[model samples]
Target: MDFVLVHGTTQSPAGWDRVAKLLRAAGHRAIAVDLLTPADLPVEGYAQHARDQYDGERPVVVAHSGTGVLLPAIAEALDARAMTWVAAYIPDFSGGRSLRDEVVELFAPEWIGVDPTADPAKASEFLFHDCDPETEHLALDSLRLFSPAVLAAHRAGPAPEIPSTVIVPTRDRTLKPEWMRQAARDRLGVTALEIDAGHCPHMSRPAEIAGILTGHA
Candidate 1:
């Protein structure tokens, strides 16, 4: 099956490199998308950019972190086959809250703002505690700043009606695993699949992440 990987905000498609490599090695096609900044456009535009990258194949869309908010629109656009969330922020549209509001309420105040990438040490500690030093360094160096507008954006419509799975990293320091479980159940109506890794599982545990994507786990 074709898999389109959508990364979280402030992240480049390179974040999915290891997972994509593993998927390709397993004979599955993978497309890691570099999401466009919503900027002045409606937040749905981000989903449109993701859909535009598709070549008409009904793909299993795997979204990581903040990009999970775009799944409903992307799935609506492509009639996606399925979706998987990796340590992602599942939007609660019912609460009438914007993504930025949800994030601010969820994380510590110090973690919010223009860019956490500016502090490589803190970023690495929070995002890559389970990863090796080399991998952590690479991730920190490649980090980018997301536009504030992206955070302020709200979902344009209801959640997509489709088969979905949530992959929760039990060791994630950034997003608590229990919180992910509750959010998945409350918002997405699905029980999360737990992994023994941190927030960036594709970087720390690519083979296992691929296994889940391929339905082998």
Candidate 2:
């Protein structure tokens, strides 16, 4: 399958270097993109950045973190498949509540904290619990504060209406694991597969992530 791995906030496609290799070793073509939500651009720009990179190739799209907000629209454009990783999948894009809905709020506050400084230690402790210090620092250093609109316009925007999968990191501290399960169930209406890993499993647990991808159609 031709797969595009969409990253979350403060991330670059470079993080998937190991995961990409894993996918190829298993005979699948994969590309990880550096979304346009540079630390400078508003969060809204990240969606556009992803939209520009989202092509219907191989018919599969995998999105992580903030990029989840854009997947519904971008995947719609490609008529492709999608897999969301510990991210939001809201619905009702026409200015009201979305056609999709979820109870991600359950895991908020404890696991995920919003600090403006983008502290690497705090972020790593929450997002990349299992990753090494250097890798974790690299990941945190890439983060930037996103627009409130990204979270604000959420329920008011379209949700991805495609065959999809949601990977919930059971050990996730960044976004609550309960939220991940709730998001998967309430939005996609599927039982999420739990993995013993952190927020960026494709980085910390690439081989396991790949196994799930291959296990799917």
Candidate 3:
């Protein structure tokens, strides 16, 4: 099966390196997209840019963190067979709220204005605490800074009708575990799959993540 790994904010394609490698070793194609959109671009532009990365494989699209807001559109465009959201934001398609609104309401005060790319120390402690030194270093080094303006610019559309699963990182320090569980149940109407890791599970627990992906389908 083909898998498209969509990264979150302040992240590069390298963030999915470990998981992608594991998938490939198991004879599956994995494309880790680099969706570092420019600050001037809106969420629509970000969606289009991400769509253009693949050739309509209808793969199982996996979204991480901030990329959740872009998932519905990207999934519809790709005609995805299945979707997996990893400690991600679930957009409100009712035209009720924006990504910024969700962040302000759901995120912890300390995580509000924090940029992982700008502060590697903070990122290491919060986002990659479970990772080894080398993995953490690689993640920190590959961070890409971008404006949060795009979050406010996002206008979510109806989510596609497909098989979707939400994976919550039980030990995550950045995004609250309670919110992850609540959002998964209330927004997606499904029980989340829990994993023992920090924010970047693909980096810290690649084998476990890969096992879930393969077994899920």
Candidate 4:
């Protein structure tokens, strides 16, 4: 099966290198997308970009972190066989507030000017704590800044009708595992598969993550 991996806002396609390698070694196709910037596009536009990049038949769409909000749209556009959320945000629009508002409310003053690309050390501490030295350095060096507008956009649509699974990082320091479990159940209506790693398990535990994706876990 083909797997289309969509990275998070602060990340590039490079982040999926390890996992993609493992997937291919296991005899499956893995395509990682470097999402277009300014990332100001609506969910539909993002989905179109994903569809344009993938030219395979019924690939499974996987999203990580903030990009999870675009999974439903991307899956629908590509006619994906399944969807996977890897330490990703499961959108809930019941609060009648945009994602940006929730982010501002959650992080307050610090979220405004915080740039992961500009501060590799801070990014390492938060996002790549469990990764090896080389992987962590690569992540820091390849970090990219996402448009603030992307955070504010609301996921305004019904959930896609596809088989979905949520992979939760039990050791994640960025997004708590408990929160992810609740979000997976409440929003995605699926029980999460807990893994022993940080936020970026694709980098930290590539073999294990690959196993999960390939139905070995």
7-102, model 4: which lDDT tens digit per residue?
887888888898999889889999998776553677778888888898898888888877777788888999999999998877774544556655
Candidate numbers, best lDDT first, in rank order: 3, 4, 1, 2
73-174, model 1: which lDDT tens digit per residue?
Answer: 776676788988898888775776767667755554555653557777777777777889888776776577555365456753567787888999988877
lDDT of the candidates, in the order given: 0.77, 0.63, 0.81, 0.79
**After best superposition, candidate 1 residue 176: deviation in angstroms?**
2.6
Best-fitting candidate, scored by TM-score: 3
Residue 198 of model 2 has an lDDT of: 79
Per-prediction tally of clashes: 0, 10, 0, 0
Structural similarity to truth (TM-score) of each candidate: 0.90, 0.76, 0.92, 0.90
* Candidate 3 lDDT, 1-217, residue by residue in tens: 9999998876778888989999999999999877774456666676677788987577999988887887877777777899999888888766557877777666766877787777888888779999988888888876876445766557676656878888889988878889889877777778999999988898889899999999896
Q: Flag regions of model 2 displaced more than 4 Å.
A: 37-48, 54-56, 86-107, 110-117, 133-148, 156-160
Q: Is candidate 1 or candidate 2 better by TM-score?
A: 1
Q: How well does candidate 2 match the true structure in TM-score terms? A: 0.76
lDDT, candidate 4, residue 109?
44
Where model 3 places Cα greater than 4 Å from the true spot, the runs are: 37-39
